[model samples]
Every structure is written in structure tokens, then in C-alpha cells.
Target: MGSIDPPPIKLPSIKLDTTLAELYKRASPKTAGLRLGLASCGVTSAVDLTPDFQRNSRYPYQDQALIKVPRRQLTLDNTNLRKSIAKKYLSLIPQRDAFIAGAMPVILFNLGQSPKQIEHDRREAETTISVLDCAQRPDLIFCPGPIKIPLQPEQDHGHGIDKLDYKVVLDGLEANQDRLTRDLETHWFLNSKAALARSGLPTPRSEILETEGVPPEDPESCCRVCAAAASSSSSPGSAAELPLFPAKCTGPRGRWLAAQKDRILSAARARPVPFVFKTQQAFGGAGTWLVRTAEQKSALLAELAGDDSDNDDDDGVLGKLLAQVTSSNAHLGPATVLLSELVGADGDGKTVVGDYGLTFVVTDRDDEADGGAAHFLAASEQNTDGSNAWIGSTISYPRQEQLRRKFEGLMRQTAAWLARYGYIGPVGVDVLEVKKSGSGQGETEFFIVDLNARISGSMSLPLLRGHFVGRGLTCASSVSIVAKGGRAGFIQRWRKPFEEGRMLILSWYEDPEAGESIAEVVIGGENEERLQELVQRVRENIEEVTL
Candidate 1:
């Protein structure tokens, strides 16, 4: 990182009343037990999900395109993975048995699915609860499985009225309204704005598609505008552009994409270096593409001539390129695309191999309303594919005291800003560190690239922190691996690191016949230095191939 400072923030001009909303507190003498209902993968800015809410949105004001919030939806498979990971977390709670009986059960309101799909969700939930094996038995009132609803028709699947689908979701939610509200005291924590909308209550609001000046709630429009502004202001020493939040743009998809390209290409011409392309709605680094030369850009433009393939993972660079290839294609529209010059830390004239992030929790408690507080959880050095994808995180603990000091005020301000927009829950701000060159002393610059307003892939860090704190140890890092080729005793075969107490396997999901698997590991040590050592050892011992 270069000279240390908080990246510049562009505050929205639209002001609102600062009186804070009250959140459901834990059960107590004066308060009823908070029956928290969970809404997984609610309606997002992207069109892959239902467009009922978007259909009702008041957008595209005066030809100024409204950029909707970015979509971070997970697949049904990842849904199971999340539950499995959460099981390990539930096990980490030392007092799980004591609290289970009295703890209010959480209802996982999921996207509507078919009868068969509903069965799968029910089986997964049952397995999750059974695996926990708590003594008292929490009243985890999940349900008769995820409610089934009709999926939104693809852009090309239908034309006139047949294209609608959100109405089905709304109908389903309305049908279950009475059951959902059987317990008047239930508090709902939703994953998408659409879910919150369907609830018809305003206690917890989502600022996602409701950002000021972004009236349309259209993902393509919102993504392109905000991305263009971010790209222009992302130079090394310039004041950083506003954090990647909603902003407005105008015209159709082609114009928007061209504008973004010109902005990014202008920067490349100025610097003559590689740049990264990003789409707002993709996951697992799937929406990222690296453009190295003008010829490559030309070739990409040429390939767009007749490519109409719409199947396969649209979350990666290939999908993003295809979207661009057919920008005008009604089937694939242009939204949520952005570009930025690749910058990294340079130590002793050499690029270092890491980035850091400050992860914290934001809640809707009344006590914090006086002036929102940044409940600083832990800072972690992020592990990724050298781009936008987040792989894992290692808790840096008290070791980042210096960086922490620089970040304290920034964190508080950011949290407060988010709260102003009605977001209440987990928030992570990713910071990029670029070490100064030839300074002959330690000096670094920091930049904020992304803000995850919801749960992140690295959620395991906070859970690991709780466990380590209870054990009087600090967690070093959490690592995620996608590997192939393992045996029946794969865990045992990888015992050297575990035997050395360098790391512990948290969870693993594999396909034996296909010989492929994915897993997450938690590493630990007494302090930061020791933690780094443990991380290296774990990495060396765990081969990318064969478990």
C-alpha cells in the first residue's frame, strides 16, 4: 500500500430524517423473544430473479438511466454449502445446548420452487439441524420446505404478459402471510429487497434499489453509470471516486457499454497497461475479464457478431463477454458492467501477494442510533484470484493496529452512511494495498474497491473469531480449496498439518465418482507472526491436486 489514507467518499445529496429504526433485540423480561425469519436469496437488482419489484419501480427519470444495486445471488447448490458451513458455526457455540430450547427458531423463506425442489431444501434443512446435535433442541421453525413459485420467464421465453413472474412470488408470499405472521413477535431478516417488499412491513428496509437519484432500479443502467464514474476517479494518487454505490446514467445498453469502454480504454492509453472488466451481477469471479491489448479488444468486438449462446455459467468473464457480444440482443442486455486499471502493492520494486479487508457487523439496535457505531469485528488479509473474487480471509486481530487506527474513523463513517440508507447486518469494505516504490521506508497507499452490503463468502472468519476468542487464541486465516483426487481417509492423509495443529478442516463436500471436491479450512496461532507461519505451512502441505 502507498501513503495511508481513507479513500474519498461521495455522500449522496438527498437527505433524510436521521431518527433510527428499532431492531428486534434478544428475548428478555421487557422484550419478547425475537422470532427471526430468514429470507434467503430474495429479489435482487439482476433480472435472473423475478422482475415483479422492478416492474413496479419508478425509474429512468428523464432519460437519465438509473443504476440498480449489484446482484450477489447464490445458486441452489451454494445454498446447501452455506447451510453446511453454518452447521460448523452452530457447533462452535459452546452454549449451543443451553440456548437451543428457548432460542426462537428461524424460518428460512426461500425462492419458490417445484415440489421436487422443495423436497431438496427440506432434506438439507433437516440434515443441517440433525448434524448440529444440540442437547436442548432449538425450535428452528424452518417450514414445510421452501415455498414453491413460478420462475420468471427468460427475456426471450415470452413477449407480452407471459413474461411476468414476480406476481407469482407475491401471490405465494401473500398466501403464506398468515402462517408467516402466526407469531406476531417474529422479526424477519431478509436477503433481498423483494422479500422485504413482499413482507409489507417497514421495520427493516433495503436501500439497494432505492438509492437517491436512481429511481429506475434497473441493474444495467445503475451498474454502468456507477462503474464509469468509479473508473474515471480510480487513478493512483487522485481522490478516489465514491465507493461503488448506485448512481445514474442515460441512453440504451450499447451507449452505456461504449461509454464505459471509452473511459477504461482512455485510462489504458494513458498508462499502456492491463485493465480488468467487471459485471455487477456475477459471482465467484465469473464476471471478471482481463483485457491486455487493443488487438484483443478488437477481436472481442468482432466475436460479438453472431454469438447467441445463453447457457452455461454467466457469472464468469466468458458470460460477460457474451453479454457484450450481443449487447443489443434482447436475450442478453447490457447492465452491471464496469472496468478499472489493475493496481497492486509494489514492495522493493516488486508486487506483493496480498490485500487486506476490514470486516464488521452493522445492526439496527436502538442504542447505536445516537450516532451509528462501527462494531469493528476483525481485519483480515484477503485471499483471492488476484481480482474481484474473494476466496478466504485470515483474521489479522490486534496485529493491524497501525492500519486499524487509520481505518477507525473511515469504518464508523461508512457504517453510518449505510445505516442512513437502511441497511442493517454484516458489511465488509475491501481495501487494496499498494506499497510505495523506492521510498527506502515503509509507506503504502490504500483504496476501497468494493462494499459487500450483505453476507460474504468469507463469513467463516467472524465465526472462527468467536471460537478462537473463547479458546484464548487468535484465528490466523480461513482458506477455501476446490480440489480433486482424494481417498476414503483423505482427512487422515492430510493429517500432518492437523497433527502439527497448524489448521483444522471445517467442512468438505466432494463427488467421489467425478473425483472433485470443495472445502474450507481454519488456521490458527497465538499471534499474527505465528499465524502467518501456520498459513505458509498449511499451504505447502495441502497440495492443489489430491486433497
Candidate 2:
């Protein structure tokens, strides 16, 4: 895509604070070309394209993580997920970006969409305020078309990866000669659960699961549940007579997969909430599902057992899982997924589970000194809405010390693992502190739940929290809200704090006709009390206008 003529809009006067400036310098010691405009990797990353892979999983059932599915569904789901990111989340990228433009001083994004649709979203975002880099006011670039550069000297226009699919964003950037070698390092390892298993860090019992349709010797052999094993030799998985799962393999491999699935299904039946299925390269909490109830387990297991005669009618967790599978008759395999223990819930393991986001910066340096080398920026507790989706984050630099100590060893190990791959950028690891479920909740367990190699979704929380890195005002909060207010009304309502520099607007996406906007904002305060009070007042003010 080509850069659009930036509409003439009022620019915010961004006064760079020395402390905040230090973070930017540290994040990009050599270059200030932090790219936020790259096309994003959505819900799923890889399509198996072939049969079941040789497993590197720790658990037996992990070998069955990849199953054959229809291809038509896979392409459609991929298209929809990418479109949603380009349309909705594209506007929210600049909130933490404008406030903390240190790491990403320049934003580059190619929506690869119709220019009209691209401009439509940009206008709704109030781009000046939404993409405003209050720290440096970074140069903005938006091209809604594919790269014209010589990516593949061998391939023509529509065939180049840049034009074929912008799904893998970095490939397009590198084609333009941006030195992003560090970003490419170890991305595959860090992208999946394999990195965590290999890191030897604290994590839940995780396994890579894969499923083969049937034994090549007996493609017609149907699993007891498969009503269509003999439907067509084109898809043996549809009618494979496998146990515990809808798939089947006749020999030793089949038995191994059966045993694995059996153990997992047994444990799932024994416990209320026992498993979480994590899709590869999924972002913004889109592909994480908690199997918490016996009912949910029953429904999910039934789907796994080849109960697809209903035409994918179920709108539950299993249905979502099917979306990534090959849904067409040709090439019916699903993308590889991860199955892990669902640590802490009510009966379903939703008890006192403390979810934390620990963000740190990795620089290319061989420090033979004391404290772990990577910069552990902020340890923010994630805030989730009623649906348990991440809504915001409450980060505190001063408070992060205790968390660092508690998970110090774990963090160091993680940082070392990332550094080993020559990766030097922002990395965030999600952690969970679980209080024992039964027997008075006396015991505790800590598990590293997620590893984000690149700049994570909530990574901007640090830019706002970094304001008080050394100073005493350490408490920081950032949240996204859908409030009823027109552009003028919304800004005027918070003008006092806006002018006073007490509260910072991260993003504002206006829905003019609906009289509402979804905003992501952060505020710095002297203490947690003041932070809470200010947030309440902001909410009250916004709520008052809503009525």
C-alpha cells in the first residue's frame, strides 16, 4: 500500500520528559525506527498443509493436537480474523503508542484493504488523537496496498508474498530493507508452546496435540463414532474409527494417541475445570478457551469424538476450534494447537487465580554483572470484563519490585531463553498465581501462562507507568471504555485533566452516529488511592454524559 496524504489535523504538543525519554533511548539504543504499522498475525499462524506432524509434546495426547478438518472453513476464518483486526483494532494501536513512542517512534501499517475502507477507519479513530505520539509525535505512514518492491525477483505482482497475503507483516517490511534481523530471530520457537517447554521455566503441564485421520493401510477403517468413515476415501479422518477422538490410526501410533486422549479425557471428567486449548500465534485473548464445566467438557469431547453431522451447528468452544480446521473436502487437517492444564478455577479451576503481565526489554549486551540483564519494565495485573476478556491493565513500577522478587528466577530464565535466540525487543510473559482449590486453599502454585516475543498488546502500559520509574508517583492504570459522547463532548468532559497533564488519552475511536466512542486511556497518580479516585471520577463524568 502507498502512504495516504495525512489529513491536516491539530498536532498535540508533546513535551518529552527526561525519564520517559530514557526508556525510549533504552528500547532503541541503536535505531529509533520502531514499527507499529506492520500487518498483524491474527488468531492462527500456520496451516498444516499436510498430514499429522511428528510431535515434540511432553504429554501423549499432545501428539493429537493437530486434526484433519475441511479446507474451505480454514480460508474463510483466516480472512475474517484478518479483516476484523484491520477494521476494529487498527485504531487502538496508537494509544499507548502516542504516550510512549520511545520504542516505536515510527508507526508503519499496510491494511491491504480498499483505500476507502482504510480511510474510513482512520477518520473514525480521530487519528490525530488516537495515533498521537505525545512523546515524539512519530511520523505516521498508512498504505492500504501491498508492497511494490522486489521481494521475489522471480514472482510477478499478485504472486509475491507481499501481495499474495500481508498476513506475515515482517516479510513486507524486510522487503523494504528495514534491518529487522533481531525480530526474525527465534520467532517460531517463542511463538508456540514449544519455547516454554524447552525453556525449563515454571509453566503448566503442556503438550502439543495432533491427530491423523486414519492408518494409510486402512483409510476406510472408521472409528466407532464416525458415521462417514466409508463416505469417501478422500477424507479418512471424517470416518476413521479412532478411540477417545474422532480420528484413528491402526497401529502403535493409534494406540499411543488413544491412550493419551483417554488419560486427558478421564482427567477432564474427574475435575471441574481441567484444560485450556491454546492456538498457535493467537493474540488479544482470541484463542484461549477454559474448559471449566462438566457440561462444557461433555460438549467439547463430543465434538472431538467426530460428532459433526450437525454441520458445525454448535456455537461453543469446540465450534471455535473447528473454525481453524480445513473445512473443505480437500485437505481436511487443522492447525497445530496446545493443550495445557487449566490451573485455578471454582469447581472448574476459576478460584483465586491472579493473572499478571510482566513486560521487559531485552537489549543485545553481554552483562557479566549482578542483577538480571533484561529490563523488567512493569508488572501489571490484567483487568478482565465479565466475559473474562482483557479490558485494561493496572501497572505500577514501584510495586513491580515485589513481583520481580517472587518470580525473579523465572523471569531471568525466560529472559535468558529469549536472549539466546538473539532477540532484542519488548517481551511480555503472562503469569498466574493460584491458591489451592480444595482443602482450605492453603497451597499455592505459580505458572507462566503465556509468552509474547514481540511488542505485546498491553506492552504500552509501561510507557504510561514509566513516567514514575524513579519518582514516587508509581501507580498507573489503563483501560478501554465504550462511552456515550460525541467528539467535542468527550474531549471537553476531560479537558481539565487533559490540559493539566493529570490524565492522558491513549486512544479515542468515535462512532459519531451512535454517539459513542471506545477509548483506551492511562492516568498517573501519586498513590493507588489517588489513582482509584481519579479513575472513578473519570468514569462518573463519562457515565453522567451517557444518560
Candidate 3:
């Protein structure tokens, strides 16, 4: 096992850390001589959802080359920045999404872009227990064959989680009519950032820039971003004709944001340095942006308002797209938006402390009298980029007592809050140890930034590291890795760690045609500094897999 180590930021790769995003996956961590699974999902039926399961992304940034370019040198060219970011973004939809194959034992996924790649991933999952020697999860069910999705034109097939085809989902439900899904409604408010601003919690200060209007008994069902998470048809906020929001902006948040348009437009004009402009629902960092400069604010607002007059060329277009990812169409209506205060960052606005993802399990007995429980599974420090898009997660807290002391209370309160709403499942919260901007720089504050209602991108970090918990290995970190060969080489390269029970390969997606693969891995180490040598060794091993 590996101890949590310094991040591989200097390596030739792109990362945001799962500032890491949300992907609802059920995770079971070892507890008191027993194994308890939260959100116990069984795959009684499989959705040969293989064909149409591509992810829905608004920007045209799906080129891997773009991601390899140094951040400082990156420009908006048709080169390739979008590809890695887009993949990272897709890996983080709010619900059970792109990389659930990693967290859950019973894998349901769309492996890369092609059917051939899907076959590779399917093989990996099928042979996981045998190859890796890890215990098979209780809720294990291997779907039949690697269903080959026939190639089709872009318009004919539906994308992955964000814009899945309702027809496809319902159609695949031919046999397993009884779906085992959680009650997202009960906990939506407590976890959503848009709602967090209104909730009375020990959280960072925030105000709604946009939100849903005429609440639908349950606001989550009507929220454009949340509603639109599963598919365009997931909510009425999404028009049936086109995958767009309603034309008129009627939400009060819209009115509030518009009224403050002048303030927002000139927010960074002078500059004490502004903060984040987050669209209510987004994966990866697509929905999050930092308004640090006037030029950035202009480009952001221009992008949001659908005005290209100020957009220069492909270079300008790429920058605008990366800066603000919510489609103009979504913003055409009252989609949820927030103007969040910065926390956990240095005075100059750089995030020195980085972000942390807190994962908790909320459980309840039907007998209301039996009061429920929320267990703190683990916490991972998120690795992100200048834009704040999350790359991966790491868990290397040597100060065990202090780690639990600081976050447990908040997680307990959060769980209690969710239980009150009669919700049960797993929840992930993103928080930061705030470094006060002004005179109070010495005094730090812990503030909640985002509460993920579903299994988060980094929720698997703890589970993956548990294999080495008893060992002397003191830390662990998860990173999305790209390699020359495919999963075979990945497995071969890290087989020793797998056999040694010191590492885990949670997710693997290989594109054979492209002769490349992307995977999410957890590396164990003695401590952060000592773990660097190990992290680099594996990184190089994985990167040069083909050879």
C-alpha cells in the first residue's frame, strides 16, 4: 500500500482533482471487523445501455493533446485541451455516472468512445477479482457479455449521464422493472450548493445568482441543473423538443443576478481579486469559474450571454468555453447559479490548502423510532488546477484525531439534517480550511463549499486505501492516469502493488483503436514526501505501459 503522497502535478498530464467532481457510486468501507455497504445496489438487470451511453458535454474540448500542454502555455486552439477536461468532467456527473465502474463492484459503464474500447473495459471488470485478488463486493453481479454498441452518427446516439435517452433507460428496463435507486429528493437540499446558500449551516457564505422558479413540491425535481443531470427528460425544466431549458427566465435568482449585473460585470474591474461563479449543476469543473480579472469577467459574461462579438478566434473561443462551461441554452432559463465567496485559498487567491472531499453514509431504519446513522467513510484532499477543475483525490491525514475532530461534527450535523428529510444513502461534501483574506489571516475557518448528494468522485479513495490501512503505509492518493498501452499494461505494471495489497485500480477505460487508456488509481505510501518516489515509479510505469 502507498501512503498519501505529493500530487503528480509536474508530470506531463492534466488534472483538477475530483475539486474533484461528483459521481454517485455506492462504496463500502471496512468497519469494526465487518463489511457494511451503503447504497446497496444489485444489478438484477443490465442496460445494454452500451450504445447510447456516451456523455453529454456542451464544449468542444475533447482532445487529449490539449490536456498535455502546460497550463501556462495553453491557448484556445482546436488542438486538444477539451478532451481531457471533458473526460474529467464526464467522470463527475452528480448521479451514478462515467466512472461508477471504479467505485462499485458490479460495474455499469460506457468505457471510452468506441465499442472496441468498451470491450476492453468489460474484460477488465469481468476479470477484476481474479486478476487483482480483491474481495468481491457483496452487491456483485457481472452483466452478461461485453455488449457491442453498433457505431452510429453523433445525432443518432445519446450521450452518457448528463443527457441520457429516457427512451433508452426505460427501454432497457424490460426485465428488472423494480429499480434499486435511492431517494435523491430527501437529501437534495442539504447537499446542493444552490440550496446551501439558503440553508443555515456552518458553510461558506454564498448567495443564489440563479435558481428554479415555482418549485415543484420538491425543488430538486425542477432544478434545471440537477433535473437535467440524469437526462434532458429528467425534469420539465428541460424542453422535450430540444435539450434546452425553458425560454423565459422566471426564477427569482435570475432577477437577483440581473439586478446585480452591474456589480457582477465590474466585479473584477478594479480587483481585490474576486471569487467563483458556479453554475448550480456541472461535472468536473465545467460549471465552476473564478472571476479574478476584468478581462476574464467580460469573457465569462459574454460566454454566458451568448455574445460572440467579443470572442476573438478559436483561441478566444477555447478560453471562453473553458472559463464558463454551462451552455448558453441552460442559462437562457433560470438555471441555478451562485456567487460563492472564496475559502481555503491564500490572500492572493491561490488555493494553498487545496480542497477536501468529505464522504459520509446516511442510513435509516423504516421504524421512524429507530433513528438513523451517518458514518464518516473518509476524506480526500482534492488536487485541482488554476481553473479549479478537480483532477483526483488523496487521503494521507497523519493527524488522525484532528482530522476526524474537525470534519466529523459537520458530517454528523449534515447527516442529521438529511435524516430529518427522510433521506438514506451516501453523500459527499467539499470543504476548505479557509485562510481569511484580510487581518484574520492567522485564524483559519472550515467552510463547506459543495455538498454532493450522491457518491462523489473521490468517495472511493477511502475504500481503495483500506487495503493498506493496517499496514504501515500512512497515506493514499487517487489520480486519473493515461498510459501508452491499455488496461492490460496498467494491470501488469501495477500487479505487484495489487498483489501486495498496497494499491488499487478503481476504474479503467481503454480505447484500443486510439491505442491509449485512462484509469483512476489509488497509490499508498508511508507519507506525503516519502510517497513521491513511489508515485513517480508507478506514474512512469503506467505512462510507458506499451513498451
Best by lDDT: 2
State every prediction's TM-score relative to the real structure: 0.50, 0.64, 0.60
> What digit string (tens of lDDT, one per residue) describes model 1 on residues 47-129?
21221222101110000011111112222223342333222221211112112222223333322245764454444344323
Best by TM-score: 2
What overall lDDT goes with each candidate model? 0.38, 0.49, 0.44
lDDT per residue as tens, model 3, 275-354: 67665444344456677666777766665543444322222222222222243323322244566665643454434353
Give the range of the ten consecutive residues with the poorest summed lDDT in model 3.
40-49
lDDT of 2 by residue, 181-270 (tens): 434323544655655754777888777654334222232353433333344323533321111213443444345445544554454455
Each candidate's number of clashing pairs is 15, 39, 30
Sort the candidates on TM-score, descending order.
Answer: 2, 3, 1
What is the TM-score of candidate 2?
A: 0.64
